[model samples]
Target: MLGDGSLGNVGSPPRVGCVAGVFDLFHVGHVDVLERARRHSDRLVVAVLSDEWAMDAWGARPFVPLLERAQIVEHLRCVDEVVAVDDVRPEWLTGVLGVQTVFAASATDGVLGVDELDGIPPGLITVLPAGRGSRSPILRAAIDQRQSRSSVA
Candidate 1:
């Protein structure tokens, strides 16, 4: 929302895009999706999920706290705005933030569930292909392995 270099013309809403994630590890895969989201719209808002919500949805707490996680995403060069949210509903951005597009990691496995995205305007969503080794599950495994080896020593 800062620069005027990319804002849409007057009388039309700005071309805003939104992406949400737990961002526990803040790995390159997170970067990949945000980069893609940036491409889909003029302004990109990255919403980092709160620790409580992450635990409720995924059954495990994020290794990183919500404020720290949001700070991590805020530093990304591709992101225009960053918010920490307890809810991951796409409508929050579309209905309140004037976001015109929402970038998801995939049709089946993005930050949002299919039900949350229901009723979204057609063609307003972009699903990026996820690459291996960048997902939280993979990073979490690595952390688990390192901790296990250290504990055994």
Candidate 2:
């Protein structure tokens, strides 16, 4: 922690929001959440799950590596800073990162459940509505179809 009791952000905005996710496939849903998150804060910090964290949490490695995923998220207009994280802790976000709000994709969908926001105040935890679709199932189906076609051929 910096002298300010949080990460060093010399000129950061007063309201900084954070969004943490695997962001493996970089799908439309991811963009929607980030755009929505940006609206609630002056600056948005996106925490891309590290490959090790992804495997440990979801039991599978991300198709896109950590650096590539971070790069993709880093270029998004809605995101101000992209950091790779091994875990998502509410205390760390609020106490260590100077984050005023933590934006989550959904409350029940395991992105950031209500129970997980223990340290952050209820008002500071924003559970945005779920996006249209996710990448995991879609990508899995596509891969399965390709494998079937190859096997048939």
Candidate 3:
């Protein structure tokens, strides 16, 4: 278990879990979320949103390329599977992965625009709070400030 409660296994039915994200900048917060998801099930499956999907939702290309982001997550010891999420509905992900639980950042406010997930199969959803100072807003602000300073200098 990494931290959130997922157990690792080799054989037998894996108690699979899922977490979906754009993972745009791949910061420490992203690491914390993935590590936590790994602790909640026997296997943690990470879904990295495709660049097109992310741009549609968030309006910009990610700092890292989609393949690079997926590879980074795949290499983590806590992640069991890494897949691309090209659709908007994350609930569909639980079904596709046969996951026991789906993890997300609590700060996301269940606002994935998918109607209530109550009826979805493989039905369990958990939202982990963002780690201290680990958020996209904070990271974005820092980047902007740094750029401003460098430009001024």
Candidate 4:
């Protein structure tokens, strides 16, 4: 996602916090993560990765386009800012946004190490509880089940 603050109204910054993701398919699990991020700070910045960035990082294009995905996040009341983050190293993003805290799902792996975490400059790292059925395998199973039913119909 590009780091341009375009989601919420410009105010006094408001102890900004953040959560970043590919946000493919705009699932309920994504909403839960954003909502949880909002609770930790007055202003929540949801970083939606760009298509090029997603392909580079994840080896595939995202299910949703960057503009549409960003709009979804921008419209949410819980989100105070929406930015495009394209960093290979995300810890730098926390420092750029002046975030007070950074939230991620408990299921997340490969997050910044202690040294990388310290480089955040201002944000405190926090992990939220992993929501039920939020994992890729579980979500894929649910989607497959729905698709199978539709095919039968």
Candidate 5:
């Protein structure tokens, strides 16, 4: 789904929940967060960061492109909808999709800091536990190391 596009299921959609991430490598951590988010809401809406925005925010381009990433996320069992967004504007995303709860898998001091969640209502944001103690930065570093080693050998 691009922009506000959504994927519909055969059953009635329930409460709206939104989760945003780069989802570059689409690893187990991403799966963990998405699964937890689905448990909280009947309808889970995911927002994937664009490659350009990812570079600006995370200082690295996604290995998987935005449209492809969106397609990958759309196919996930935990996701009811997938949105390709430029930035991680959680407040705007919540408002746009009528999201009841915003699920975050990042540390408060790191990615999902207070500044990114300014306009969202209190208690609406649920900070989920990290998956295998891994986040984007850690995953990216691991991938980079592998790539470097491969290139060296």
Candidate 6:
């Protein structure tokens, strides 16, 4: 568990599943995806995107820092392990982390953009539907922007 600051292997499960994301502002949608992913495999590994990757990919730095985001994810019951990932490439997740299945939220509910799915086999990926707890980081960001502007005005 990354919360304890240890990256020790949790031993191989019947199936090892992975979900990678920035996890900038933890929300119900994040919990929804993690718990759902855990159901598909015996163990779940969450990859918290590094600050650099989040900034470069989104053109905006994460509201929460990388290590903090990782620690938050590590404490989740559904996650067996949390790792810091600079890249979302399939080879890195499979070759390095030994992930058997990759769980991802659909475009509307996805923190990881579609480009991150490139090169991964379709069969190896599980796309969770946009659930009641949908990923609305964009909406959150807009609200924050409006609030900030009002405050300044």
Which one is best on TM-score? 6
Candidate 2 lDDT over 77-129, as tens digits, reads 87789888888777778787888888876622324545544556787788877
- Which structure is stronger by lDDT: 3 or 6? 6
Alpha carbon lDDT of residue 51, candidate 4? 87
> What is the lDDT, from 0 to 100, of the residue 4 in candidate 6?
35
> Which regions of candidate 1 are displaced past 4 Å?
1-5, 8-11, 107-110, 113-123, 131-136, 145-153
For model 3 the TM-score comes to 0.71
Candidates' lDDT values, in order?
0.72, 0.74, 0.67, 0.64, 0.71, 0.77
Runs with alpha carbons beyond 4 Å of true place in candidate 2:
1-13, 107-123, 134-136, 144-153
| Each prediction's TM-score versus the true structure | 0.76, 0.75, 0.71, 0.65, 0.71, 0.78
Q: Please give, for residues 53-114, the per-residue lDDT of candidate 5 as tens digits.
A: 77887687888888888998899987888888877564576668878788766642122433
What TM-score does model 5 achieve against the real structure?
0.71
Instruction: State how far residue 40 of model 5 sits from its true place (Å).
Output: 0.4
**Per-residue lDDT of model 3, residues 119-140, tens digit only:** 4443466666655435677777
Q: What is the C-alpha RMSD of each candidate to the true structure, in Å?
A: 4.1, 6.5, 5.0, 7.6, 6.6, 5.9
Off by over 4 Å in 4: 1-13, 88-95, 106-123, 134-153
Clash totals, every prediction = 0, 0, 6, 5, 0, 0
Candidate 6, residues 100-150, lDDT tens digits: the string is: 888778645445534576677887787776654654667777878998999
Give the residue spans of candidate 5 off by over 4 A. Answer: 1-13, 107-121, 133-139, 142-153
Of the candidates numbered 3 and 5, which has the greater TM-score value? 5
Worst lDDT window (10 residues) for model 5? 1-10
> What is the lDDT for 32 in model 3?
72
Between prediction 1 and prediction 4, the one with superior lDDT is 1
What is the lDDT for 123 in model 3? 41
Angstrom error of the Cα, residue 29, model 2: value is 0.3
| lDDT, model 2 | 0.74
